[model samples]
Target: MFNYPPIVCHHDFSKSDLSVDTLPKNVSFVRPHLQTAWGEFSLVEATVQAIKLLYESENPPDWFILLSGTDYPIKTAKQILTDLSLSQYDAHIHHQEIIYKVYQENVKMSVMWQMLAYRRYCSWNLFSLPFFKDFTIRWGHPLLSKPSPPFSQKLRCFAGSQWFSANHRTAKYIIKFHSQKNSLTSHYRRRMFADESYFQTILANAPHLNLKNDDYRYVDWSTKGAHPKTLVMEDLPSLLASPCHFARKFDIDVDSNILDQLDTMTLP
Candidate 1:
């Protein structure tokens, strides 16, 4: 293992099975955890909280990596650490400019379209009839102001995977920016799947952060669904061959064989 300290941020909504007392001295939890759910700003806030804490720690790491429980390392710890050491970019963040787009009825759309639709629009609870809800209809204020701070014609929106790696400098920048309540943060609070866009928007906009448009995480999305394909034993070959340091959406319950094999491969 890397042996780097971890600041576990528990979601307020879900109880953590981790025994706090048994955890190492370097491992701690973020105080006053908030309710977190998929596609919610709470997920963003949780990440921000952990970053802030880690950045302010007594012995802050030179690099920071954000990951979920479902994620697993494909490369060895030494390989990952060595990669970060020789990396030129401040952050490995998968990102792209998000365009404002509307859905076409009965038309198959890409995930980008789905991301734009849910991220740009807000749902209302105005309808209460049977099989009707306020959120059933998506409403948006696409005609943003000429000078919408943090986001406008000049400062466009960018989005990407929520998980990634960043150097200490970029990590510091994130905490400093997010610590203040800003228009960007406010707008993100209103949108859905804020986790995917919030950090990306900030990183993309920062002038000094040397960013690479690669998150170093492999996720198979070939199958049809809003979520990525759950990794299994069949994916072992691709996972090992990929340049990515990590691969995600693994389900040990579905097939622990994959993880078992990886464990053998990763043993020093």
Candidate 2:
């Protein structure tokens, strides 16, 4: 089994809010100071910094797996490390192509028209208007226009699912790419849901980061919905049956029992 160390990027909000006391010994928790007007950027910076520090230490792990606090391991850390070490691939999993038309119809109307219609309304109730504030926060710039170009031609595009694991070389490439591509990053910041799109487009388009197979994180998108479907207690049987190492969107508050079941079935 691969024996690389795990780095967990936890939010400062969790320290006082969540009840996580002792993580696994191999896991390193990095907490970034929260910054206003740059919710996701703070996270990105913190992760980049953590990676750079690890690289500089001369004792960096063989691979780095990026995960969120909401994510839980469906398989043992040993199994995940072992699988990655044995594999001969140098790729990240990303959607081949996103269905933009869906966004054009649902998201555009909700984002663009609502903005145009209620610009003054937003200004009137700055604190009270949740929808207006959300709209302005996400897509407050000119670049995120409707009828976005097809996935191939768009010099500046977006992709979904920011979760990924990469070798040290690829991690370095991402850091350099972000530094160099300021224009693209700025454009992305103003767009809605930049977190998902930013990383996906960058990794998918990069020539060196040949993301081949979807790094098998089991997400239940079975129910008809926009977001990836959430996992519940009933999904345990199928989740364990699958070979994926992790499953996500489990509610820590409500569905913790499922974790107990998984720990019994998958981990030693």
Candidate 3:
């Protein structure tokens, strides 16, 4: 039997069944309104919708954990639930003052270049038109930064892992905070790398939850890229030995062996 609640959010409602089929009996579906802004805005809308569903539910979940399509469990459902119950601390984690120098540098350069390019081209063709000038001036700044007072003080921010598990009260705060700061949140959501930085910063700044070690699944990051290294059959032994409850970036294609091994290990 499954020990915790599960909720799935899909970009496309029609494809929801694929995920629903894989979940155990306790899981349910919470579909977000289709918002196709990409990156941070998309994630913000998805998060807000998920929390709203919980608030409206007759019996809300004790906690909510976010996962991606690429994630897989390394521990049994029972083991995970048991571990969570024993902890007094809320599950949200943030690495304090984590340096994100590289990301900041890249964002500054990219923003500057985009502004220059848009001014050069759009100024002549688009801005020269009478009504278009006011429209362009009003909307053009949004392309630079939306809803505003930028999300973070740093030029760029590093988001270690996107996954998190938060108790119901904490989840409520996240939703409420965003609602009050809708303008600022909306602006930063359109900015660079806000997807990773926004939530991390908000949670870190929250008074209720303590920022500590990350509680979600773990994956080796020695290789380097935008994501953690995908687990392979060869990595099975080490993965099993690690205490992390989940690990991810699994290839849905050829990484089936790792999943097979996990099934045998966690289920048996």
Candidate 4:
């Protein structure tokens, strides 16, 4: 559907289906070394490897978009390329600092504590008390204080959704940064949800990247819970109105008709 050549970086982790021999010519299947796990950096590592593989391919991509198996495009491949080509942003990623000021605006103080409920640095002792609990200290005073991040103050941290879209240059920068075992990377590897903060922290610190604080992916957070609400046939109207390149959290088993509608609908 695209005028330009599009290369897809697909990494399958399921044990049931490791073979990709029947995939389209454009899809490049990547092999991940580690199993999927929560609060682990393996997912982030696999993603970086996939990006590296894409860059090394014969027909390297002009843009790199991070997505999961559940994600689906809301716009045609041609439309996506045209929109990205006309834009000047180096990276499209949403970010917000994990501090009181940012969270206090719309979230209660209690909610803030729950968000950072896990102290990833303490993951070394899996058998110890407070194994995966947040850490707080008296700090020689009656009131408790939150522990500082493992990294030095020089490297600021930002948190957001893991998904992103970026030009090839930005993708190169991310891989380069990941290779170094600096305090930032070491600290992030131990983070509870490293996927959410790893790339955001890197891009936010690099001022020369021309970052835009939007990933152009529609995700509904209005519903209560950790995961976003799954898209259904009823959401087609809003999905199109979002003006986003993709909308995620779709399940083919639950509602495949939405995909049919999206495939046939004409963009205005």
Please report, in order, the local distance difference test score of every candidate based on alpha carbons: 0.78, 0.59, 0.60, 0.72
In model 2, which range of ten residues has the least summed lDDT? Answer: 117-126
What is the per-residue lDDT of model 3 for residues 42-93, given as tens digits with 9 covering 90 to 100? 6666766776776667778777777778888888888887877776766555
Per residue, candidate 2 scores C-alpha lDDT tens digits across 145-253 of 3433233354534354567777777777777887785555655554434555666667776766667557667887666465566777998888878777777878867
Candidate maximizing TM-score = 1
Structural similarity to truth (TM-score) of each candidate: 0.84, 0.69, 0.70, 0.82
TM-score of 4: 0.82
On lDDT, the leading prediction is 1
Q: After superposition on all CA atoms, what RMSD does each candidate show versus the true structure?
A: 4.0, 6.9, 7.3, 4.4
Task: Give candidate 1 misplaced runs (Cα > 4 Å).
Answer: 13-17, 101-150
Model 4: how far is 28 from its true place, Å?
1.9
lDDT of 1: 0.78
Candidate 1's displacement at residue 128, Å, is 12
Residue 125 of candidate 3: its Cα lDDT? 26
In model 2, how large is the Cα lDDT of residue 236?
Answer: 85
Candidate 4, residues 29-116, lDDT tens digits: the string is 5654456676578778878888888887887777878888888889877788887888799989987765423334568534453345
lDDT of 4: 0.72
